[model samples]
Target: LGSVLLLLALYVLQGVPLGLAGSVPLILQSRSASYTEQAFFSLVFWPFSLKLLWAPLVDAVYVRRFGRRKSWLVPTQYVLGLFMIGLSRRVDALLGDGQGRGPDVVALTATFFLFEFLAATQDIAVDGWALTMLSRENVGYASTCNSVGQTAGYFLGNVLFLALESPSFCNKYLRFQPQPRGIVTLSDFLFFWGAVFLITTTLVALLKKENKELTPTKEETKGITDTYKLLFSIIKMPAVLTFCLLILTAKVGFSAADAVTGLKLVEEGVPKEHLALLAVPMVPVQIILPLIISKYTAGPQPLNTFYKAMPFRLLFGLEFAFLVWWTPKVKHEGGFPVYYYVVVLLSYALHQVTLYSMYVAIMAFNAKVSDPLIGGTYMTLLNTVSNLGGNWPSTVALWLVDPLTVKECVGAQEQACGTAAAAELCTKAGGSCVTTLDGYYVESVVCVILGFAWWFLFGPKLKKLQDEGQSSWKCKRTN
Candidate 1:
């Protein structure tokens, strides 16, 4: 229960920025209330998504210092809690004077990014511990609990909380007339989430559970010099490289497709209020998707089953289909035209179902192939690569969102950015936004193409590796 709650809290906090930024453009902001503004808000996601970069550190340093689960959890929970409270206070300052977009977005997103990093680091520990602590017999059951918690967190975090227009801020900004300030700023309503995480951490600290009997002792600990050292050694292992490469490539295209689909809603002029409706499908997703994915396995299966599962094959087709089919309408009428959000949600739901199913299938397969005694480290290596997978799209997306310079947009502002900040920045300055949108589209298309290409190029090797992953470990077989 503690682990599940802790995971819930972490997942809940993860959506704070999404809810906040989605609501931002509608607020009485100086910037154009355009899709361009939404793109700016999207920039906040890079930090959270790129968390794969420092994942090894979570295992090597953060976990090593305090213990895998606790190190990341303790400081992260407190910081997120305190930081959110600070934001609530900061809002009094920003909205107090009605601060500029430059100063305001920067301040909020910086703290947001830091909190995301903490959240990301903590995820590694949480996920790792999930793998380690649950007796092999109970893993499928434990995964069900974790998924439920995580799904609830996303729905509550993004849907329920974000959808509520800040009455207080509205009451203040718009006066007694009750002009709704569509959504609050990044620092707006996160204090509640801070409480959630703080409570989770407190509960986790209080819970007493069985420890890993197989975990190595003092002298074994002395072997790890640092996070980076541990990270490098892990990556260098033979199948580990194969895992990392596969990991890095696997998600990039799919994520790009996913990102654009959401952007399509905003770009097509769908309201954040409409986006709130997207959370509805998450109910089924929370309840059914994980189980659907786990259905094929019984104490792990053969790699041939993985190959037959068509993990990559199905994802390739579904992603492409999702991107093409879920086109968003620009505006709404008497009744809500939240259809775009709904379709997109379904797309995402299916995408996640396939992705998790494939991911677990692969993991079980890897467990079968690798020496069972080294499960902890090999699993850690898989994580490191998964982190790498997360990084590529984030860096690309950030670049796309950052906007080119004022010079490139309309005239020269001299003070703005270069390609280094993301050429998309130029388009964000008002006149050039469409051009940036084109760039984002192009990037997504490129990612999709790459995914297809990867499917063809790496297909055979992945088939072999996945096949090996299915073969039961001697240890697992005995059990």
Candidate 2:
């Protein structure tokens, strides 16, 4: 019970940084261009994809006296706390709050990129630790802890923060007298979490002792160079290479809906705070679904659950596009009718089901297939491929939004507002850039079509890979 709770705490801390980074897009949607916001997200998330490069080092190089996991975890958390505190002092200025100047996109990217790098390092340590932290029979619970803890932390950082940060939301629900700003500012939140990180790290360092019995013998423990070689050998296997290709391409179909839908809804006039709040109902859902999904994924054919969930998720993309189209119609002078919220909540709930189903299935599959000899490096490699699959496509979708959109300047300047600069010029010239077509819808259609195509081409391969004997994925170590 204590180990589970500790693992949960570490994962929650890991998740908060991700939640904070994810919230930046919502905060900047009104202030920054879509492409710029996407670029920032792309850079911040690069660390997760690239962290696999250092996973072998993280797995192999540690002070035996200090504890392998704690050697990395303790220092990484300390650095993370200090980094957050330093960033809190300058974040407001960097975001251009109350300033006429636009956000410093490059600077924000660099800062958060480092922030995520620290978090990713922490993730590698914790993931490796989880394998040893539990009894073999109970090791499966690590996925549950990860899903629940991370979801809870993300809720606190994104949804709850957004709601509390909105003056209107606070005034409507939580306050007797309205203030000009929400109760918590981003800086205050950052500073508070930074303190939490420091305190938590101190407690863990003082109280928690890693089980030395789990440590491999001197002869069994691979050096950093040997660990990397093992990683490369694992990748060279035909089955493993095929799996990596599948992981890299599987998310292409869901990218537009997953990355752009919420932003598009915000663009279409759903308040960001309200949109954040919409996720509130899913908190419990996110926590519970993983436990339930784990049962199905524990079978020999874990990818079967993932394969079945894919089409439903793809279908939700179209549903989200429809919701974006319908939002304006439901929106009124004051606010949306109650039924609009119901529809959205119901739709989103269904989407969450499919999303979590796929997520848990893939994670379980990763855990099942990972080579125990280099557990951290192997699992991180698979996770990196999966994350890259989602990241690159989302980045591409965001980049293409402006280009695929069709608009015209109507009124004083009657011209095609094909670019953001043209649209800005149109607004300055007393003309409005009227959208003849929304890029989101077009992208959604293209993504769904591509998703189905992928399923047709690669669906059988996924099943076959899952059915392959475990020995096929094992590294063939040569002395």
Q: How do the residues 1-479 of candidate 1 rate in per-residue lDDT, one tens digit apiece? A: 55455444555555454445444443423223323434454455565445555665565554444465676667777777776676766654543344433435545456556656666666666665665555556666555655555555556656655455544434644565765354554454677666766776776666734354634453245334444454456566566677568767766656555444454444444445455655685676656754665567535453344444444534544454444434432334543355644655666666666566666676665555555554455555565556557556644653554342132445424323344343355545433422323444555556667766766677567666644433232222211
lDDT of 1: 0.53
Runs in model 2 lying further than 4 Å from the true structure: 1-4, 131-142, 218-220, 371-376, 414-416
* Candidate 2 lDDT over residue span 1-479, tens digit each: 89999999999999899889888887777565466466556668788788888877787778989998999999999999999998999998887864557777788888899999999999889988997898788899997888778887887888888888888899899999988999998899999999999999999999999988986566337787887787789889999899989888989999899889888877777778998888877777877888899999999889999989999999998999999999999989988888998999999899989998998898999999998875566787787788888888888888888778888899864655877677788888889988889888899999999999999899889878988888998888898
lDDT of each: 0.53, 0.86
| CA RMSD of all predictions | 7.2, 2.6
Per-model TM-score, in order, reads 0.67, 0.91
Error of 2 at 164 (Å): 1.3
Worst 10 residues of 2 by lDDT: 32-41
Ten consecutive residues with minimal summed lDDT in candidate 1?
470-479
TM-score of 1: 0.67
